[model samples]
Each structure stands twice: as C-alpha cells, then as structure tokens.
Target: MPAADWWRSAVIYQVYPRSFLDSNGDGVGDLPGITAKLDYIASLGVDIVWISPFFTSPMKDFGYDVADYCDVDPLFGTLADFDALVARAHALGLKIMIDQVLSHSADNHPWFVESRASRDNPKSDWYVWAAQQADGTPPNNWLSVFGGSAWQWDARRGQYYLHNFLTSQPDLNFHQPAVQQAHLDNLRFWLERGVDGFRLDACNFHFHDRELRNNPPAALRDSTMVSSVNPYGMQAHIHDKTQPENVAFLRRIRVLLDEYQAIAIGEIGADDSLAVMGEYTTGGDKLHMAYSFNLLTSEFSAAHIRTQVEQFEARVADGWASWSVGNHDSVRVMTRWGGATPSPELAKVVLAMQLALKGTPCLYQGDELALTEADLPFEALQDPYGITFWPEFKGRDGCRTPMPWQGASAHAGFSSATPWLPVPPEHAARAVDQQAAADSPLSFARNILAWRRGVAQLGQGDIVFFDAPEPVLAFRRDLAGAPSLLAAFNLGGAALQFDWPQAAGATPLDGHGLPGAAEGAGVSLPAYGGWFALV
Candidate 1:
C-alpha cells in the first residue's frame, strides 16, 4: 500500500542497443559496448536505463520482431554478456529495464512456425488466425499501422493470419491462457537474471475482441487531432486494440511483478492516448506507469502543453504518467518543434519544462546535448519503415544514426568497422569525447541533469502556472518542506522584456547551464532561453 518508489522522480535514459556503441568490429553495438558506456550514461544523473529490444531477432523491424524472448541475440552477445552488463549498470546505481515484445513474434520463431503448419497443429490457436472472406479478402477492414491490409494469407494453414504491423510479425492470441503464461515466464527469465522490470512494447495492443467486431468510426469532430496527422488515427480502433479485457491480462503481469517487488512500465500507444494512458495505469493492479506520444510530436505552444497535462490529471486519480519530448519514435524534438532551424536556447527551455512536470522524464539517446535529427540520404537508408514511405516519409533512420563517441575519431569511435547506420556529419562534432574535453553541448546536458538532481523544487513540488502570453511559459514549483522555485522560458526566437507579478517575493537563483544575461525577470528569451531558481 506504499507509494510507487521505483519511478516517482527517477530519470530514465533509453539505449537503442544497435546504435549506442559497437564493441566488436561488426559495426553494431553489443552488450560489451553498452557495458563500457555505463559510466557515461550514469554520469548523466539517470537512475534507470531502458534498453530497446536485443533478444533473438531477425532484425526485420529492427528488433521489434522478436524471435526468442529468453535468449540474447548473437549480434548483441550471449547470456553471460548480458548478465555482466546488468551487473555493471547496477554498480553505477542504474536499474536496468528491457523491452519485452509480448504482442507478437517473427514468423521464424518455433511457436509461430508450429502455429502456421496446419489447422490440426497443437499450436494452431496460438496466433490470431481466421478463414478468409467469400471474396477471398481479409477477415476484417482493420488496417495495419504500416499502411495496408492487416491479414496475410498463409497457404499452408489455408487461413489468413493477423499482423498489425509487418506481415512477418503475427499477432499473438492473448485469449489463449498458455500464451499469457508463456509471456509471464519470459518476464520471469529477466527478473531472475537481475533485470529490474520491463518496458512493455505496445502494451494495450496485447488484447483484441474475440468476435472480430469492427471498431466504431471515430466521430469526425472528435477525431480531428488524429485525422490531421496520420492515417492510423482515422478509425476508432476500439475493437482492434485497447479492449476492456486487457485489464485482466495486466493484472496477471502485475501479480508476477509483485512477487519479486519489481515494476512494469507500459507504453500505451493508443489513438486516444490520454484515455488509454488513464486506463492502463488506473488501478494499483495494472501497470505501474505509462507513456504516450502526445508531446513527442510538433506541438510546442503553451496551450498544447497545458491541455495534455490537465486532461490526464482529470481522467484518473491513481495513475502515473511519463513525459518525453524526444524518443526513438517520431522526429527528434529539435526538428519536430523547432523546425529545420531550431533555437539552441529553446532546447534548454523545453528540458526545463519537462523537469518541472509531475512525472518521470525519459531522455532519448543524445537528447541532453540537444542533438538534432541527422539528415540521411536515400542510398544510406536502413530502416524499412522509412524506406517504404520514401520522399513522403524518410523513416526513423535519421533519428537512429550511431551515437558519436569522439569528435575526430573515425566513425566517432563507435566502431572500428562501419556502423549499421552512417554517423551524421553534424553528430560527429557533438561527440562525447569532444564534450568531455571542454564546455561543449554534451557537457551542458550532463551539468543540467546533475544540477536537476540537487534541486528539491524540481524533484517534488506542486506546479503553479502564471498568466503569460503565447510563447512565454511561466510556472512556480511550490513545496511546503522545500524552497519554492520560479521558472520561466521564451519559446520564440526573439527577445522581449516583460514584468512579472512582484507580489511573489521572488529572488534571483543561480542559472546553471543557461546564459548569464537571460535568467532574471524583465528578461526575454534569445531563442529557447530558460531559467529556474530557488526563491
């Protein structure tokens, strides 16, 4: 009955294993590479490290299409390598969390291979399979997120199988108790191996309506936000995912975590994100916390930020939220909100805002130094998702380029061999070694993160908003036991001096990483300038 201590004010750093660092000469990151970089990660003041999928995989959807849940991929290393990495991370006081794709698996997986053999196979019901329509089309009108039919015809089974993303990745039949138990066993494998918890990939998509009912079309007026951005938001998606029965499955996983005092953080990537985030984290028996893409997009105004936080607070009393402006998915924050040309100072403002919000903050790799989305040419593209969309969409390869380790070293010292994705020209200039030598962009990030940990107001406090104009965001962090803090930021590229309410008895607080002339009130932002202080 105690408060959730795992993530209350913790900072989580995400490591996309393939791009973090390369130890061997294969041009890909391995467990040893990650182990070597733990100090760099821990030095950023992050309390947890959530690594993306590195389990046995075919690497079709990168690592999202998992082949085996319990085994480590050779590309990454062996079980002993992983165990060593976990120990090294814990030595740095970092809790390790691995991504578990329980929703589906690669067709090459033995379970999937057996399930697709024939109708009479013992594993036939393990995946979502159904007879084709009279017209020889898919069973339902459900569209895949990757843009097309959700069903693939399996000639051997003589029945179409469901795939919400790629055709090779079939949807797991959560209705089967054995499937649920198998996923739980996979969780146990990691828990016993010293992993702290899991970052459940597409958590709400684990269940579906058994009747194969069509989702009700979202009300045109109600669906405006989603309809404008992507095609996946066109439908209500009620039946295809976020089923009411998902609660029972969540409880099953939560119960397992409870046994070992572990925690689970679910990624609620739903069309109605706020509502889905509420449901997934509502009760104590459900997920410990959940995150969505509400702020990961290009929305940057004060109104948009306020509406997102306020709406979630109104929905549930016991739920916890995780906020992130930049992540592995979507465009980088610098490019997404600040456009192709971003205000360097504005990046600090956004970080300040995230630190002030009432939730755990996830920092994507290279975000602290305010790394922008690297431009990659068509020939060098590696991500199929981005390649298929072509000129319309350039894929995630830009944001996923290799992490630059040194400013002048070949390939930024990530590997002696070529990397899976080429390092960007601009990224090499912001390398870790360069940042370590002097006051560089990467060092700025480390200082900010380290200073945030020392500030009580930023760690735990009630957020109070002040009346401000369009791009100016003003708020106060008030705590009864801790000193009150006043914070302000300029969202625009211009500078304008303005007077704040004088009744707050606020005094100047030292500005750590921001410029000297930008901290005080009657001050204006020089493009992304932000300041926080104890009053």
Candidate 2:
C-alpha cells in the first residue's frame, strides 16, 4: 500500500486510556502507562494505535467533554507525557491516533464559560443558544441523548443552550465561522505535535439546523444510537444533528490532514448512520474513513453482519469504512454477541471475521483476552448515564473496567492502589500473562494479524457475500490478477457441516489459527470456527 493509503489495509488497536493501564498507581490509566505498553501494542501487529480522548476535561463524560482542545488533562498527564508516548509509539512503528471531540466542549471550557457569561461577550454566540418559549419552556423539543431536554437554561444569558449529551457538555455552534476556525486551529496544534491521525468523535454532530426547527417524531423507533428507554430516539433528529453543513467542515478538516499526510476516521451516530458515513467519506475531500454504531448493537447474526457491509458497499462508491464490533461505549462483544457463555473461540472467530471484511478493523483494548463485560453493582458505577437509568440500562462502566495485566498481582497489575473500577475476577483469570499461552486467543489474534499482512487479496479486495444459512456467514474477497479469497464463519456454538458451492475446487488457506476445513464443496466448522481458502 502507498504511504498515504497505509490506513486502507491497517488494523487499529484502540487504547481507552482510563482502562488500559496505570503507571502512577493513581487508580486510573495515564499517558505514561500507554507509553510503557507501546511494545505490547506493537506486538499485536496492528498498524495504528487509536487512543481515546485524554484531552483536558472535567470527566463528566470521561474525556469526551473537552475543556482544552490543545492540551492534555492533568488526570492523564502533561503534554510532555503525550510527547513521550508519541516518540515511543513511533519507535515501535506504531502510528498514534488521538480522539478529537469537535462537536461539543465541557461547560467549563474557556470558550463555553466565556460564551455563557453574557450575551454581548466576544464568545457569546460560540454555543447553540436560543431564547425560551412564551411558557418558559426550552426553545425546541430536541432531547439529549443522555436524558431530558437537550436545551439547558442559562440564567446569565437568559437563553437555553443545546447539549446532545450531558448538560456539562455544551454543544458548539459550528455556524459561527470563528468557532470553525478555532477548532481548525486546534487540529493544527495536534498535527504539529507529530500525531499520525485523529478519530473524530461524533463527527456528524458538528452542525445543527440554523433554523433550530423542532424535530419530528421518528418514522420508526430507533434504538441503535441511544438506549430504547431514552426519549432521544423518539424523534427524527433532523434539525438537531447530522446536518449537511458538516460535509463542508469535514472537507476543511481533510485538507488540513492532507497537508500532514495524516488520516482520520469519524464516528457517526445518527438515525441513518451508514448513510452519514457514506456522505462523510465519499468525496475523499472529507473523512478518510468512518465507522458507525451499526455493528455495536446487540444484534449478532450472519445476516446482520452481512447487511451492514453490503449496505455500505452498495451506497458508497468511493468511500471507506472502519468496522468495529467493540468500543468503550457498548457492552463487550463477548457478552453482547457471544451469548451467556462466551468462549475464546468466539473471540477468535469475531476478530477473524472483522479482519476479513472489506474495510479497516478496529480492536478494543481487552477483546483479545476474550474479556467479558464486568458486572458491577449500582454503587460501584461511575458513569452518570448508568446512574440516571439504573436497572434497565447499566451504561458503559461495564466495558471500561481496568485492564488485567497479571492475574496474581494486586489489582490485576492495573494499579497498586484500588482501581476506579474493580477488575472482575473473570477478567483476572484471562489476564495478559495467562492469555500469552500458545493456545490462547491473544496468540491467535497475533497469528491471524501476521498472516493477514502477507495476503494482498484480503487487504485490497471487493467483498461478495454468498447465500448461506443462518449462523454461517460466507463471503469472497476478489482482487484483480489474484485468486479470490473465500471465507466462512460459524457464528454459533454448534459445529456445522454445510455445502458451499463457492468453496468448490478452492485451496484451503491455513495458519489462521481457527479450526475449520473444506473438502471440495463440503465445509465443516467447529463452534465459532472460521474457514479461509484461495480459489
């Protein structure tokens, strides 16, 4: 792959800074902790390390609520620690990609603080503010993704400001040219800091309708982006987010990234996230690639996986996608998709399937260890979203538990002091030390990644799914002047023997570390097994 197109065939390993490792015994992971783990990340054979937000924040929504876009938060470390992390990551040939939350800022952010102080200040119009109605209600019916009204009344300004997430995270007014320029300047700061790329957080939420029109009721109940219990999903969200103005802003961002030969992958959470992903990445003058919440839902089926890829490929002629099944926000894939008793075989199969898709694959921190979501009591939860809606929806704290480095060490070697969240005993049993064994899922992850690097067809190929029964996903990756690579994954627990016409006369591709075999047109797969071949 060309240097500029390096991300095309790359694998991104996401480091949720708070849960990755703790170097200072602060009970929270930090930049130095990530720096110390560069070698281990490099060992995974992933090309990029997409670190989640470690920027200055008040920790309302973890680091997503940025207070200083250009500086690191003291909780994570100083800018010097971030610089050291970049240097170490580069030494290991790992490209560092940090999160850029451009849509909103912490209410305490200087800009928000200044904007909310008075209506006549220089930054007064920086945020989305509007006057209340005759009845003293919010300006509109837009609802927050967390809960309640999106509009928060600011007594100082005598107006309401929009917050799609927590009230502490105030939405930025992208309609203001100065706000746009300020964010651009912030991007330039990181670009000059020697970072390779950025993971644009809520990239589609950068713009809202200038008219501030009331959003209509949803044509259907949408549960993919927000929890079903939240009223945020009841509306179409037409006026509040995913506006067309975002396309231009994305182009502006791409131009800056092009100057540094840096790449960007946006995170899209909209009513029609796949469509927004296509819109953001189609022109190449926008995002380099984008991923959506489509795959992060609890729906795990061969049909569901096939539909997501096929739909994107059908709509996006010149765009790209970064497919991710696990992230900090959702329940761990093991528990969400793999049922009550998720096995290591399930992890291997999921990773293999994600890798075989016709896009970049992003792996979450502990998925390689087959880490199940940690079950915590209500008192132990730190996530505000969970605290608000306790029983029905438990929030993301389950997936944000500390990494288990050593099974026998105190706090699983995550920290000498007590961790912010307890490391589940189940996760401790599957720590890095134990998962390093030859037959472990971690080893399987390393082996498959290494094997994938050698296969050009798998990296650059057009995907075509075969008509297979439920619980079995079959697809072929075709590239010019090379044999087509055929893949079949058994998504369920039972061993399956299926007759696949596409696999006839295909040469079995081995060394992938999963159990499966094919003889002529007949294929056999163990529980959660995958089969690969070159035809």
Candidate 3:
C-alpha cells in the first residue's frame, strides 16, 4: 500500500506521441501538442498517460531506438516542452509514464559509438560485441527482429555487435555493471523531472546468454511463433533474449524506481509472455505490472480471453497483469476481431471485458472510438521491419496513423500541417467530435473508467467465471466483503440469453450505448453487447 501502488486501479492511456496532435506546423506531434490535449485525455477518465518513446533518436525504429536516454528528440520538442507536459498532466491528476528502451540504444547513440570505436577502449564493453566467425559471417545464427542477422559488423573495432531488433538498435551489454548503472541514471533523470513511471520496452531482452552461445534449434520454429506478420519470433529466442539474468535487471530497475517512489510496467513481448510475465514480475520488488500481445492479437473468442486471463492468474500469482486489445504494433482490434468493417458494438464489448477483468486496462491511442487499421500504401510506410517484408507484412504504420480529432479539419485536426502518416479518410466519421455528439463510444469509455473509481472488485478481485451459454461470457469478480460483480458479454451476431448468477442485487447501466444489456438477473446481450453489474 504505497502511493505508487495507485497504478493498480489506474487507467493508462497510451499516447503514440507522433500521431497524437501537432501544435507546430511540422505535421508531426510534439510535447506542446500533448499538453494542449490534456483536457481531452483527462476527460476520458484515464489516471495515467503512458507516452511511447519521445526520447532523442534517429527514428529508424520510430522512437523505440534511443539515441540519448535522458534527452527529448528535437522533432518531438525540447526538454522544457516535456517538463511543461508533465506539469500539465500532473495538474489534471494524470500521472505521466514515459517509455524507456533500456534493452538497446540507437546505433548512432553516443554510447554505441564509443563502445564500438575500439576493442579495448573504456567504452568498448558498453555494448555486446564478439569476434566474427571463420568465414566472416556473424558469430552466431541469431537473427534480428527486423530480419537478417542479429550481429552487425562494426568496422570500427573489427568486431560484430548485437541487435535483437533493427540493426540500427544495438543491444546493450547489461553484463557490464557500468552499463546497468548508466541506464539507471537515465531513469533518474526522468524521475527528477517529476515523471511518474516508465513503460519499459522489450523488458525481457535486458540480458543475453553470457556465453554468446548459439541458440538451440527451436521446436515448431515456424510462423506460429512470430507476432502476426513480423518475422521476429521464428527462432526460439532462448539465447538471443529472455535470459534468466533479466530478472535481476528487472529487480535492479524496480529498486531504482522504488527509490523515487515510482513504478515500472514492462512490455514482455515473447511467445511465452505468460511465463515471462510470471518471471519478470515475480514479487512486489519487480515490475508493478506487465502487458503482452496475448490479448492484442486478432483472437477474440470468449473462451480464448477466459483461458488467457485464467492462465496468467494461475501462473503469475504474485504479479499484476495489464491488458490491451490494440496497440501501435498490431492491427486495431475492431478490424482484427470484428468482421469486415469496424464494429463499434464489438469494440465496446471488448473494452468492457478488458475493464471487467482483474487488471489494469491500458487503452491504445485510438481504440476507444473504434478505430480500425488504416490502409497505408507501401509508398507511405515508414516502419523498416514492415518494408523489409512488404506486401504480406504491412508493418505497424496502419495502427500508428494520426488520431482524428475533427471530422472535417485538415489532417483530421491532428495537425495544422500535413502529418507524418496520413490520417485515414474513413476515420473522420468516428472522430471525437462525431462520437462526442451524445453519450456514445467515447462517452462509454469515460463512463467505464469513472465507474471503475467506485469498484475495487473490478480491478483486483479474485475472478470466477460462471458456466454461461456460448457467446455469453459471464464471470464473477469477488473481493471478499465487497459486492461481487457479474459480467456478461454477447460475442455472437444474435442476442445471447444468460441466467445471471444469484448475487445480492444487480443494477443495469446500458444507457451508455455500448454492447450488452441487463434486465434484472436474466439479461439478453444484443449481438456483441455486454453488461457490467454492481451486485
């Protein structure tokens, strides 16, 4: 029970800074732009605002590759602008959590430059570097998440450096204490700026197998393991990432955050994310919470969601879980789960299901208003990983498109000028102004978050699913003396009739215009609708 522990009941609104809003005439989002939109985001009832990396970078991997861990990118704005953003967000009672890419640094980063300059230089040990193979190939067969070899030939020292992601992102040698301390110092810089916490990127890749041993052949090393389209997960990734040493690093990070009264939420991107989430957040001393692509992928069945939440609860006993059906990395959930065109009803049902679960619900940039994947022409794609495996893999650009604020404004009012990625034309109809016309999708999202403020069982209660008929996913979230709530969802096209569990009392709140409705104890879910109760 600490101040930082407040994130347990918090609603984290993830802002893809580049696509958020642009105050300058540059078309790209900046810190001042986010500051301007503080009222809009706070109105959504989100307690925390988790900004994707706005750190200085070459932007090869957008802002994921950090060139300067402690500084803001010029394109995004200056450090002063960031401070102003933090101040404004705090003034609105919104906690600010910035993205920290500790696993790797931009290849152009000063640290990497120094580390690869000389084999025996003071900084040579900062990054992972090993000798070349006999035929001049990379030392091992480890492949980059962006494709090709994970080892990049650093001509500066006649040694190959490691990068599990893009070649421009060189993996840091966490084996070095100095490297670990340096990264911790970067965290301190933000903490000193009154930043609340961090969403650690690739949190499991902090350590590599120390021996530089080649990863053993993986079982079913096929497309099934990869993240949808990107070929990053073909290998078992045993040696390349998720090393046992990462737990210690996480503990170290937790210790650092603990000192400043901050919390850490890790992005555990692995095929076995459940197990990793179990490991990365083993105790209260590690990550406060961790999220994965388990729910983010296109899988939308009630059974699938039940299994995922149950598996984590059974396996990750001591850890907190975070769920997001949509993010910048994958196609929007509306298109991924809902058939053909976007289904706002299904989207609301999915969001309700997420909020009903016993965990923090993180909303992606545009998921609230039922945003679908924008069609980004290959010519306009900026993600190198997507470009490398083009046509079949369209990259994450579609999901990272600009947020539409106004229905008719140029660039959807996301910017005064042309935006970095064009706003989808279809997005105009679902714009904030359009949806906020009355108590609509946008309003429901706000209602759910606000309603969450009074419900403790909905956030951290022990969940027990009732044996309801197919398509009607019903469950009870119990927190001892607190009233156990019944959550029923209709995932099918036809209305689902469910016999709700006998709880103390039930009150229906379907006026929000979302999916699902409740009529006393017997409720009928209107095709892809849901109902949440305070029993």
On lDDT, the stronger of 2 and 3 is: 2
Q: Stretches of candidate 1 above 4 Å error?
A: 1-6, 220-230, 437-439, 515-526
Model 2 TM-score? 0.99
- Please give, for residues 345-405, the per-residue lDDT of candidate 2 as tens digits: 8899999999999999999999999999888999999999999988899999999999999
Best candidate per TM-score, number? 2
For candidate 2, the lDDT comes to: 0.92
> Can you give the TM-score per candidate against the true fold?
0.94, 0.99, 0.95
> What order do you get sorting by TM-score, best first?
2, 3, 1
Report the error of model 2 at residue 62, Å: 1.0
Q: Which regions in candidate 3 have their CA more than 4 angstroms from the true location?
A: 1-4, 221-231, 499-522
Relative to the true structure, how large is the alpha-carbon lDDT of every model?
A: 0.81, 0.92, 0.83
**How big is the positional error of residue 33 in model 1, measured in Å on the Cα after superposition?**
0.5
